[model samples]
Target: MLRSFSYVTDHTGFCGTIKNSASDFVVTEIEVPEHLLRDTRAESLQKTSEAQLEPSSLCLQQPKKQRTEPPSPCAEGCHGGAPSPSERDPSCAGGDCSASPNKKQPEGEPELRSGLEEASMLDSLLGKPMSELLNKFACDLKDAWDLENNADAATREFSLGPILDKKDRADLHSAVRQKFPFLVTVTKDNEMIVKGNADYRELCQLVTEKETSDFFKFLDAKIENSTFSFAPDGNKEHRKVVHHFINRKFGRLLETKSFTVTDVNDQPNMSIMVRFREKSWSRKRSAGGFQEKQDLYTDFSYTGIKDKKAITYQPMVVKKVTPERLKEIGSKMEKKGMRIHNIHSACQHLRLGQLKGNHFDIVVRDLKHHSHDSSADLKERISEAMENVETKGFVNYYGPQRFGQGQNVQTDQIGLALLNEKMVKAVKLFFTPEDTDDPVNNAKRYFLQTEDAKGTLVMLPEFKVREKMLLRALNRYGVNHEGCTKGWLNIPHSMRIFYIHAYCSKIWNEAASYRLKIYGSKVVEGDLVFSEENDESVSLNDKVHVVTAPEESANKYSIKQVVLPMVGHSIKYPSNKVGQWYHERLSKDELQMCKFRVSPLQLNIPGCYRPILKNVQNLSYFLEGSEKGIEIEDNHLNAPKVSLHVSFDLDPSCYATVCLREIMKCDF
Candidate 1:
């Protein structure tokens, strides 16, 4: 219901109303360039920045103070006002210090040499490629430190594959830091991650000035070389995000392998490898050429979450779709307030989030202003607010549409019920009355008052397909938990996932607000940044990096790079207060990090990260002629006549409503 999200800019926003009519809000999808679409390969490993060659203290010499301790979430204490033991010790002050910021990690080069001996033992066990990867990470760490000092940046995580040996992984973690004191190491699913800052300056450099041809070419090449495989490394969520994005965008054009192997800890660990599925004909023709195939033996193929009601992707046998058929479809869509145009033949179907951006032409109806303020003064103030939006941008909160539109029960509430496995409760919440006089609400009331599903079905309109299905299922199965669950399952998979995603969006908004409140757009230590762009997909297979040291990395990242997690089993919480808030917030919901899955329904929400801020493109605003509905006028004894016309472009999935809310600085 009216949750408050943080703002990026501090400006006296132009107070106004919007969406007075259907024509008031116009949106057009910005198609991705065909050239860019030709090449969509993921990015490669980050190269060592040129700054690494410079003689920086962080790179050349081991800093005496190497941060070794984990950040204490409760540095200020949990229960009483007293600080915890870790907080009391000077060695762990602010959770940023290791052992007194001046204390040497191993005390000298003699100890460092001994640590190297330990490193050698571990390196021998890791094999050449993984060992080389570790070394690469060390170089990356040096580069990060060097870059952080010169320019603020975010960290990128490097994998040392999966270290099956617990002792070896631990030794490597300790020894690697001893050798490269600037680096921080973390273990995830038996894999070692060498945390180093990513060079955001390189991110900036990748943006070329030549837009028409050369820039698109470079961008396409850059994306093509990008990494999508997580054969032996990467966070499961990160891999899943990539996997889901690819799967959703390209259908079943690619294949991935998930290997479940036990580690030294006697726990099953997953190693997934994602690659393009070779065409059957290609495999037959290249028998000799593709000899060295990676062994893809597996325990079981991961089915992921399946929606029983989803339409199976099948080969369509169509000679040609007639113009009359297209017109028929267009007419049907127009009745539903949607228009389909730009008809063309395509080799493939268009997938979600394939667009470059969206262009918005929003018209604000009644503008409220002080009685004493003149039209020119109001225009100046509005112009100033618009400028602030262009410069500082706005928080990219999921707008109210994501929650639910004028409903008594939010989608997330139903999602929470589903997650809690109270299927009957979830079904009940879905059918809850919206306090409206519409036929749908009347049907809901009839269903609630009388347990006659058949009667409710009679009252529902023909357009209410989901409602009718649910009622029919209930009429057949009865109103018990078993019946309700079966009825719920009858709903489309897309709608079920939408409810769940809405719940995720709720958490993301809260987390984003907390982060903004705590840090105020500042990238701090332990903040997360995406190693690759997945176009805001939830199946982010953990391709995220932790900011190891803010002083060295914060300056390198813009507010756009910083992101907050959606909170799931596969995600790593930030090693700071915001991360702590995730736990505290989830605790209130009676949920834990490991409980993000509803095993019975096969619903696994391995959450992904979302950027806190989004910069608008091609923003422009102007005052339009007064509409007839104006209640107040500019010294003309009429209503507010300032009909503000605003236009801007935003990346796909971004909310124009949120952007408008930011500009207006009012709850709409």
Candidate 2:
């Protein structure tokens, strides 16, 4: 049986039956009392009369004349035409009112209106049919509703003065206008005020990320009742909503905790251990769509999501770090080469009173020699190579992670566009449609590429939040690069940096390969060598040393490690045979070292030496399982039959695939 809920309010003398729709929370079927419906028509008409009489009188004066027939129905939870009493909210409007300008008034009556600051709403487009108007405002309506009811962010105590900067304030104002195209005006007086055609409280909470304390009790009560009483088989999805809010609240509290568990992918990631602090809040990875990470924690370790696929974090240990000095977090003064990106990617963490030293392991599989190779034969070959690998070492080639997956090379194209300062091309590609299965989203992307922002805005489905944001930008500002810059920049700072880094990775990989080729005469005068940097590495090189002669150069006998710069303005090119390659690459691309600048100061990957080779550690393989007739990537896996599990550990900044390639000699 489908679970349903009925609410009766003694306050409004209103009663109705509500059931959860398949779409969740939305009222699919609402049955209001017949008398209540009669009241709504009367009230809506009455408000139309009074709005013209006086704007100030809305809260203060009585109606000019009293009706002899009956009380007018309230327009409280008003959404669309002839709202049922159950949907009407008394707090919004009572008796009679026209919240929108498009609502036609009776003959010979001046227009009556309520201001936006008092309610959360969006305007219906004037002179358009109901169907067209609804389609145009579909996606934006969802955003307004989310802001108005997101109880966690809506605390009575929240305000704009404490959190937003001048730039943030301006951006928010633009966002409000963009969200509701018919929004009359946004004034700068007391924080951001969206004047017409909007829900006042919803817009306030949306921008300020706070809500009144009055709703806290109601929110808490609902969560507790729904969560504790939840049944897996219940038709109502209220329990899922409770869990979502709980997880969201928990993620916020993690900022104060010593350690936070983050969902990496298939397994628990390196973020298992971290020193949480306020400064770390600025990291791009820290915040997400559901909640701001800097938010306060009401729950610490609530693991209600039981399924393995659903839970992102696993239990891990964390310890408090006692700083010897006033350490600045989210600043560029960290011990050299300690960029935030590498820190998270390499899984750097504090251990044994110091920060990060040899503390990670990687497990790789699928190492068959050829198409028909048996599991046992592959394991024997891998075992033999492990011995030789321990002695020689694998080249530190920039693995597939550097290039991105498959033939798309989208990142490479984005990087090239960024390097050339082609902002339009870069952002256009980002919002453009690929061979995606989502036809609705793909159609919207096509509209954007064609510069039909208005068409795309209406065409978009409600869930395309990101695309809607892009279309709104193009709508407000023209559909051009100059107008679209603001929206283009809104694509998270980390994402933009990643594109540029892809280009740099390509250069680094080529240079590493070049260095290895010239190893016969390794370490000539003016040659740079690896700084013997380890996982505990942080900060930039304060001193510069150059090799003047082969004898003065230091090496670990046959180990022979060399360092290559990652193509930047501050790069140190080799003066020997390898130096020409760097100069040629830079000249061909018309890129100079001084051009590598980005926001937040830390993403600037300055000159540094990365070792050319790395040896796999604890390398071993084993046979396991079998495949009947499964297919992978359109290729049959029956021949390989799931065997040869390889386990090993590599230092930070090394790809496990490189070690595997040396052993198996096959593209993976």
Candidate 3:
């Protein structure tokens, strides 16, 4: 059947075309023919019935057009009162075909015309030439004919250009996976692509796992907290950056030479054992606190060296030793006639007592070569040399020890002798006295002057005698004597006269006020009663109110008795019990008066012991009330006064005396 078709060109109006065979197409100029439209419709219906076809195919063809005129389908009865194509079909018969210009067949048939027109419009928009549109029916038929052909391969090859660029490929995969959401997979080349939601999830899981593992490995390598950025495009830039950072930071720590990790029990994660190298040495000195002048024997157990800064001893093990070559060293010593026996003896002595042996290396120091050097220069040179050798890592060696002809004696023994002499002088100065009559005063003077005596005086029994006689003479004349006379006083009277000048010196005049004083007095009832006139004629009643004034007398007085005021006409002064009662009463009254002085409760008392009695009363009240669980109210107006009682007995043999003075209302 001849199928009519129409197409619009860029510069031409719609033109008519016709296809009679699969490959034959021709342009035509024809007027509208109703029979032809009817024929075309019949033929389309026949084609549709002959084969299983899509409803869209019925509107695939267009009506023939006329030449030099606007192409239009032949419509019947529209302008000439004939039945119109709209009347033939009230609805579209096929895909969007109702708009067709042909009026024939049925009302529903024209509906298919609209679909044909829409298809034509779409085909034109697709930029295909009218020839390709004309060949659409044949193309569709050919697709059916080549059903077994590799169409997918051809389609894929054609689609490659648009999909192959980096960005485009990624976008393509994203779109495909988003649309299909089921076909995603890792490619044979390890490239990942997703076609479904589940595939995308799997890809994401793999990526997350990889990233997590990498992150942990990175953290394991890091000693410090770090921040890093990962490439947005799944590149490993962040990993490389972190690796470099870790290596750089930790590399220096690993480079220390003095410290080494000696043992590692596990790879990657394990405890490391480390050892550090330290330089050490020992220092020895003579008992006199001086460095020895001779070479020290070095063979010794490790007793660790002292840290100069902390001045603390650190213990160490001697890992190695390099003493002087025995033959060469011994020969040199023999040339100087310095017996090896001496060195051996010193070593044995140090070993036996100090647990040290001659393990030290010997370095001969020539005095002649260093004679012109100052002491500081020599010291610096020695220190620098020692430091340099120590830094060179030599084995343990002994330092120098001092020994010589005049100096071979122990320095400590000499120090001991000097100390002994000073001690003896100190003892003599303490025991012997310039003024010896008063033994106690002389002893005090000796102690005070001992430091000034130097080491000249020696303590002896004779010196003590001289000290006593001198003290006696000074006591008699009321003079102080300088120098010890204890030893001289032990001599006979004749000899004592001879040593009098030796015992007394003009130096005594300056120190006389500090001299000891002695006195002879009578003691009565634990009190020393001095006679106003040397007559001693006064009776007790006559001396009742005669007060003995405190004096700076040369003589020392002994107190024989202490007397309290009598109460009423009590015999025996009320004995011990009454005295105790009186004391308690006085204390109580004094305490009460003290409280009343500041409190609202002012109590009165007779003369003497008022403060004492009040203090005792207040104290008793406070203690008693506190025990009874009664709170004592604070009384700002009633402050308590304290009273004190003191008594003493004198020693006549030692000439000791004490005086009591009473103070009343003593604040604070």
Candidate 4:
């Protein structure tokens, strides 16, 4: 007999079997329990199938015979066999089914997996998908901490735009708080809680999208204008307080203030007023005194007046009397021999004395009457005698006298009359020599010196009858020539004699009798004249040529040869020819004398030997021979004396010629 075996199936679809070796029998058709099969298939297909099955439908379809009894094993006999359908546990039937086997983890496994899944879901939702929550949390935590840390920090609403999602608002809030810690605030009622005073509130009202972008601009302008003052003893803390106060209270007002605070000379507690006013003040003060001051006027005076009655007379010498007091002295003189003819003469001779000082012989003429000496007869006699005469008369002889309107005796007026008859006698005796009977004899006796007289007198005779008679006599026989002739001489002899007389008379009358003394050489007719005016002891030896030329001609020819006149040992020439010789032939002294003798005629004469002539010619040989005399040898011509020709050529060449040698040797 075959040995028998048995097997059992679990809900997971895994089966267990037992076998005996002696029997050699096997349970070959072992099936899993239906409930276990259904459960396992459902778990296996869980990834694909999700719909649930009903358990009632599966139970209703079971066979009647199968339901009556469970099937048993045959005689071959396996004692434990696969359970029949009816014998399988109904708990495993399918509907929603047993939990999927793969999903049916062990006790703590499901809880642990659920816990990890929850944690992962939360991390995804909060970190990536809902990052706004994370940002909000972070911002809230920072804000709370700041509030707790700083007393000045307060919670307030801050507005983010409506376009800003939760995440953007959270991010912006965080950024704002980080950047401006004191200004950061949370939103309350959709508006930001900006921490500021009334001015800041006003600024907040002004904020827009563009204004927010430039929010720091106003702050910068305020900071620029704000001024902080510190006390002398103030420390840094005091300065900081002052700075804060200034930055807050007047932070916005400072932007509009005209003045600012600056340290002047290292002192910080000062304010500068930018707007100033101009005014003027006096620089001088009035004088002060105790007594009342007098009224000031331009014409004010101080000295008082005195009474006019106090005046007293001081006597002065109004007039003085002299020992020679002669009154009506002019009339006394007039009674003696003088009388006036006119008012002018009377005024001229008023109150004058005669005495020893002056004498008078006066005549007055009555021009209206011509009878010879009645009252006018005596006047005519005196007038004829006094004609053409200068008579002495007084003219306010005591200083100057004045007699006119408002004229007082400011000047002395002692009148004087005088008689001077000498001028009248001189006039009466005046007559030319021609008026005499013998004019030549008269001129000789009166006007001409006796021993030196040579010419006849030629008087200026009048054209009267007596002068005509004398003239006719002179025409017959010429008068002795001595003086000037008067009137016309019609006769030729008389005229000729008059001219000669006039000529000689001029010479004798004006010139001295002695001769003019001559010092130098004298020449007459190309020969040296021995002058009687010079010393007779001197002699001349050397020969000289007298050079003369016509005044209008251009050529000079030697006129004659004469001994050179010498004064002492020196030769002399005429002053007209002083410059007309070569330098070699004459010493400077002799040349000077010759130069003095050079006249303009000689200078103009061509071919004449002059010092300047050497400049125009090559006469060096002549100059040398003349200097050394004719005895000099010809051999000496080649000596250094010949070099003088070179010097003379060079001197004139400066003005005339160019040196070819020098030109050829020139570098340029």
Query: Please, what is the whole-model Cα lDDT of each candidate in the order they appear?
Result: 0.55, 0.38, 0.23, 0.22
Alpha-carbon lDDT of model 4: 0.22
Q: What is the C-alpha RMSD of each candidate to the true structure, in Å?
A: 21.8, 27.7, 61.2, 78.2
Please identify which of the two predictions, 1 or 4, would achieve the higher TM-score against the true structure: 1
Worst 10 residues of 2 by lDDT: 43-52
lDDT of 4 by residue, 513-581 (tens): 111112121223333222222221121112234444342143332111122221111233433332222
Model 2, span 461-571: residue lDDT tens: 877766677667777887666656655555544355567767777777776666655554345665565443322112223222455565445552232435566665454
Candidate 1 deviant stretches above 4 angstroms:
1-3, 41-320, 328-340, 370-376, 532-542, 550-554, 627-639
For residues 151-253, write the lDDT of model 1, one tens digit per residue.
Answer: 4324466776665444455555544544444345677787677664122122122221111111111111111111122222225664465446435533333
In candidate 2, stretches whose alpha carbon ends up further than 4 angstroms from where it belongs are 1-380, 454-471, 520-525, 532-539, 552-560, 598-607, 625-639
| TM-scores of the models, in the order given | 0.56, 0.43, 0.11, 0.10
Give, for candidate 4, the lowest lDDT window spanning 10 residues: 345-354
Tens-digit per-residue lDDT, 283-343, candidate 3: 2221111121234233333212221112112111111122223334777856853323221
**2 versus 4: better TM-score goes to:** 2
In angstroms, give how far residue 237 of model 4 lies from its true place. 99
Sort every candidate by TM-score, greatest first.
Answer: 1, 2, 3, 4
